[model samples]
Target: MKTDKKKIIVSVTNDLVSDNRVHKVCTTLYSMGFEVLLVGRILPHSSEVKRQYSTKRFQLLFKKGPCFYAEYNFRLFLYLLFAKYDILLSNDLDSLTGNFVASQLRNKPLVYDSHEYFIEVPELVHRPKIQSIWLWLEQKILPKIQYAYTVCQSIADVYNKEYGTDFKIVRNLPLKQNYKPAEKQSDEKIILYQGALNIGRGLEQAIKAMNNIDGVKLVIAGDGDIREQLHDLVLQEKLHDKIQFAGRLPLEELAKLTATADLGLSIEEDLGLNYRFALPNKLFDYIQSQVPVLVTNLPEMAAIVKKYDVGEITDSLEPKQLADKFREALFNEKKRKVWKEKLPFAAKELVWEKEEKVIQEIFKGITR
Candidate 1:
């Protein structure tokens, strides 16, 4: 028997080890009979990727800044130009230029997945000249994109209004799992903050809040540019005994670690539009693990916290304010129990199984 399934190429800018969303998307597409080849650039520190679908990581000379983006996109453009792909999936704006140009030249369908508002990211906030380049790229490419999707409805609305493109909303939700939440092993509660240790993540405030938050250990997982700085901050505050940096862990390992935590934190500062409209995967990850969360009162996050009654939302990122909120959430056993009780219902609605159907239907409509 011969099956004729379309071949799809998915592109991203990061090494694929910690990208749970992209991995889930590729898995779903593979199950639907698509021959998937996930593409990304390799850094000197990138770990070997082992997966069921084919993956390629291009080694480039430059590692950061404009040089890296230009070189990587050029290589990606050349690769996509010559490769045999029925559909090209570009993840985020950084990868869009290469995929867009290649898709246009090759006359293949291109699906744009906007993970965040690229031009509004914190990195670009200080550099206007550099920001202009990305803004221009987005302005030119976005209107021409036939099919697009974003991680949240807020971002989707922004794109629709800005570019007149009908972008669908497919949230970056966690995969459904059967593992039961681990019982607290230690007397001290674990306060976990997972994901990239990047700026504008309110980590400084979180670390400062630890001074007031006793009988709890702050566990900072994942790696980013500010990891060393954060470590220094912990040491300077003389809170090394109370704070632990787990670095980056594989998604499976991270899940196991997340399950043990008593409370999860996602206190993204309102620095830009991207953070304002942000709906990070860790929020859902916390829910899936049946852990109560204490998130900042941003639109997307606040809406989830309010609607599901799964966690508390803090109004301020000030250390004292955050500390007060953490104390309230951690010590209030009745509230914590109530929040944990709602996790099953929240998890059912937020899992990737339901979201995958949207991706499948979109492909069915576009490919046919």
Candidate 2:
């Protein structure tokens, strides 16, 4: 029963449990008749992933810092060098080097999906030498990639201009669902922030803003490096009653939680190119759940918010301003109704069913 089908190997740097984007992509590729194997590393705290397609997670010695990257890439290179795959799919710049080298050595096509502007991440903003290394790697490998896609147009434009490579945009939209709006729990409003609890995400300001607003609870439903610090901030501000952390729910539970919220927040600070251009998946989740949003006035996010009239966009990240905006979004019944009315159409438009066609076309081109 050995059927002849093209096998694709996709690599990323995160534990695969909560990566809805990667899961969607892999599922699409599987449905399209490609034998897909999604690869990632297993951390000490990594949870078990239940996927439709095959997955392989390497358990490495080092889990963070330079050693981690080096060890993971070296191990990945070896794995890709020997493993059977017709196409190599690299998730981001961090996983590109090994995949690119393996593809070149094996004479297979390499498809890169840049999740963000890697060199312009907040983590690398202060580290010049490390940033330079990433930049060098990107410059070296990008020119060789024949099939490439990114999460958004702004990021794709930067890649195209910088490397003279045409990268297609396949946004990280939510899958179409038969969504019914959840009934509100009580008069106390729920303000939600659902993504990586990382630096430059404006979580600190959001927490601080909660102090100024009353009769509302802030629920943060994700985990990252700064989770401890954020918890400490909540304690220091004495906003324990106002702020609660629901660390890293699965996509299903997250969607349910999103539906229950009065307002969704994506207040990313403009600390780097990636942050400025970020059209986070949580925004789409909010839209799909028919919840209003309060986003930062960044180009990618603001355009959608304005176009669909989903919510308000603020130019300032100040606590007072954020608190005021939150109050307005929550208490402004007329405006909230208008935003809710637009959500169905926005949800219909922004979905995986529409975006997957572009992915199918790109893979068809690659296979041809």
Candidate 3:
């Protein structure tokens, strides 16, 4: 059951695709000589998963809601009990319960990676009773976690203060690239929004803003809760000619679409602390594509925009105001030249290679 190299069982709640941060972490672990096995759940309509290491995806009894979480965790607990792993890596709150219990019982090291301020996410912000259940889980488990890290400084500070735990910062950055994408041969310029089509993501305002932004197509390249609503809004607003729903794409295809764009967007509305402090993975993906971004004037994202001189930051998501931003990003030649020159340096600096060293530091002496 045991091999020469240590075995790691990395767990996440989502299907093993599109979650670049967790995917990068698992890849890094394997490169460091660990035998990696990534475990996640399978939806009825989930895409096929292809990874370098061994993998498993559970077909659970429930699809979503509380029952799904319970079923997944219960199933995961049983799997971990029998699975031979020297270390356990849990991504986010949903998978931590099983990993935590298994770690204690089997005397294995556990590392927790919090992808976001989970309880304060917009989905749970209005549901206090449901939020409390997650809060309770965090309260009971987080303070006891030794090797824990999060995506940004804001989330790390909040968790460290609340739980008195020394949580590290491992930002959601893309892998370093040596390849260039072929530019589009289209006449119309493209303005892209390439993350989840979820609420509080400023997609509605972005679509409305396109009414005045002539000659540029607004390409939405992901799918989520607001999928139908967004499609309806496009027709209702009569923006079929101006807006294109690219739907959810795999990372490679998404990068090509991103590279073809004139500008990238990460204009999340400040609904809760989760959104307020979000340093979205799409932001880094844009950088990797060398596409300049127009992002919210929130602390975490604004810091990157300002620090790198990558693009503009706006305080409002008003349709008229958003149109102004789009116009400037698309047509302002002087600003475009500045952003174009700055993007490569930002891309090189903000890569997973630098962040994975911190992971190495956390897991030092962890292998036998």
Candidate 4:
């Protein structure tokens, strides 16, 4: 099914190897026999990740420094102009400017994938003027684009209602279903937390909950700006034995560890609409692994968790209340079994496979 036609150019703002969206999308495109000219930043080499597709990286000179949005856009614009691609796929607002320019120059279709609500980003939440600028840009740019998509149904509806644009829903689901090991250690019930270690992500609550509970261990498997702060909090609370920082393990290793976990955690504070409606990849990761969850009481998350009866949900922000719910989830085997029963359905229905046809239809619309 391989075609000799020109490749699709997908631009991303982050390191491609580590980011879930870029990594999964590139793999999916390769599987569907599309030549993907992936443009991203190159990270330090690690034997852990062996990428499967061809990529054209614009490696940034400084690894750690202040935000260089202008510099990044200029470099990416030059690269996109020279790359000569048939279709332009922009990951987020960060790279949208370059993609928009490239699409106009080359007369190619542009696909914008909004992963998060940029206006409500934690950093920009307090700054009204900055948020206004982002909103203005989105209003100016999003309408002219022919194809658009987002992570969840709620976000898609928001875009459709606000911008009068039709956006396809593409949930960030896991690629496979896995079973728990035959013999998992019952002594240490592993409570798993992954994704960026940010404030209002319910990590502080997860840490605080451990203060009251015993015989439970938490494995934090990712890194972020707040990681060191969380580590310091764990030390301050003297819950060293109960909490462990796995420090950004490889995807394969993280999956294996997830399979062994007793419960998965995806609780975000309702600080913004984006966090309020998040259906995180880790939630599906837990489902694929057949582990129940302790999720927040957000409507979007609650719809799935309550539908499947897979885990518990709480709107309470209190640490003690969260701990009590965790205790109940850990102890009640019957309640957990109800959630586990939906594993096969959750695995099959809630994946990227569901979005492929919708994506194809959008492409057909643009091409016609």
Query: TM-scores of the models, in the given order?
Result: 0.98, 0.98, 0.97, 0.93
Each candidate's lDDT (Cα)? Answer: 0.91, 0.91, 0.91, 0.79
Off by over 4 Å in 3: 1-3, 179-181
> How does model 2 fare in lDDT?
0.91
What tens-digit string does per-residue lDDT give for candidate 2 at 41-68? 8888788888889999999998888888
Off by over 4 Å in 1: 1-3
- Which residue pairs show backbone clashes in model 4? 310-339
| lDDT per residue as tens, model 3, 1-368 | 22368889999999887888888998888888788999998887789989988889998888889999999999999999998888999999999999999899999999999999999999999999999999999999999998899999999999999999999999999998874865578879888998888899999999999888788999999989999999999999999999999988888888778888888999999999999999999999899889889999999999999999999899889999999998888889999999989999999999999999988877765653
lDDT score for candidate 4 against the true structure: 0.79
Clashing pairs in 1: none
Segments of candidate 4 deviating more than 4 angstroms: 43-49, 61-67, 178-182, 364-368
Candidate 1: residue 94 Cα off by (Å): 0.6
Backbone clashes under 3 angstroms, per model = 0, 0, 0, 1
Per-residue accuracy of model 1 over 1-368 as CA lDDT, tens digit each: 12277899999989898999999999999998889999998877788899999999998888889998998899999999899889999999999999999998999999998889889889998889999999999999999998898889998998999999999988989999885969777799899999999999999999999898789999999999899899999999999999999989998899999999989999999989999999999999998998889999899999999999988999998998899998988889899888878888998888999998889888887776
Question: What tens digits encode model 4's per-residue C-alpha lDDT throughout 109-183?
Answer: 899888876677676788888778778878888878778988889888888888898888877787765464636
lDDT of 2 at 297: 91
Which ten contiguous residues of candidate 3 have the minimum total lDDT? 359-368
Single out the weakest 10-residue window by summed lDDT for candidate 4. 62-71
